[model samples]
Target: MSSISSRDRRHLTNGVKEHLRELSVQLALLNHRVSAGAGLKQVDLDCLDLITRHGPIGPSALARRAGLHPATMTGILDRLQKGGWIVRERDPEAADRRAVTLRAVKERMGEIYRLFGGMNAAMDELCEEYTPEELEVIAGFLRRTTDAGQEVTADLV
Candidate 1:
């Protein structure tokens, strides 16, 4: 195999950074459109997604994960509850009666899923072009990128 020169490596690194930045912006725009179509704010929709993926989760924990203030999370949760998108349940097993967990209204998730169906399908089609090893590498890269983003966000927050 031919070794990459330092200059070529730097070029490839810059290209990857640019593409990742573009991908982030495009994803945000897509989420904004999907949120609009679903009649929900983008942040609210994002919180709902978090709830769906990590349900039986406490409000405080969810707030941390979403990088939202507790007050902001309260409003979002209220709206979601009012819209029938989520349910807040008191932890019966806990000593504190006020400890509440958030859960997504699974039946009401169809609309959100339908909104994202096109993008999901496209992603699946794209994945079809890659072999298992290539897919694994892609997945690993994405995972590391996400972790890095979260780390930076945590520092800022």
Candidate 2:
């Protein structure tokens, strides 16, 4: 394989960073619109997304992942529960009898998914432009970027 020159590598890296920043802002705006459409606060929707992605998760774990305080998480959880977007149930497998886990309410997910349908469709169309190998590389970069963000968030917390 041919190696990129240092100058070219730096240029590519700067371009990627600039694109990522722009992507972040655009994603935030999209999420804000989605949250408004769903009648949920941005943080609450974000927490629900975390639970949907990582459930059945404990409240404490979800709080950590969302970078929210436990008390704040409790309020978010309560709202989600009241809205029928999520449920808290005793973790039968947990050794601690009272330990509860958060789960996204499957039946209620349709509303959220519908709100995101446009974005999902756009993303699918975007993915159609890339070959599988290129998509894999892009996915790998995104996964690594997400991990790095989590690590940095943990440090900040």
Candidate 3:
């Protein structure tokens, strides 16, 4: 095995742990604000995101995409439907069958998107302190981390 000093390993490992913890705290706060009183949780948001991006899909597919179990996705659809945030329509190709799809009620969701957009803008401004090359390096690192996570999780199935 290649040898690395304990100090060097600790430096790399501690930075990764610190970054993960900070990301978790930040995401929790963001979710709290976006999901407040919506009778929805983070999984619900993930379902919505999948539907929004991919258009109408069967509950099974939606569940798979959102990393949810099939039965739980059914419950999520019911809640979203009851809230009028999503609608289920008969699948044109399949008579007497419907697909669960989601669309944002623009009036209700626009404000949230705007708030999110504002936060992004602020973050971008903060990032301006770094040169474009520095930001590129950071982005590359993040992308590699994300790709690795996806690969490892995909292998578990």
Highest TM-score against the true fold, candidate: 1
State how far residue 113 of model 2 sits from its true place (Å): 0.7
TM-score for each candidate, following the candidate numbering: 0.96, 0.92, 0.73
| Backbone collisions counted per model | 0, 0, 0
- Model 1 weakest lDDT span, ten residues long: 148-157
Q: How accurate is candidate 3 locally (lDDT)?
A: 0.74
lDDT of 3 by residue, 33-89 (tens): 776645567677667667777767777778777777888888988877777667776
When sorted by lDDT, best at the front, the candidate numbers are: 2, 1, 3
Instruction: At residue 54, give the lDDT of candidate 1.
Output: 89
Q: Would you list the C-alpha lDDT of every candidate in the order shown? A: 0.94, 0.94, 0.74
lDDT of 2: 0.94
Question: lDDT tens string, model 1, 38-145?
Answer: 899989999999999989789999999898899999999999999999998989987998899999998999999999999999999999999999999999999999
Screening candidate 1 with a backbone cut-off below 3 angstroms (N, C-alpha, C), the clashing residue pairs are none
Give the residue spans of candidate 1 off by over 4 A.
Answer: none
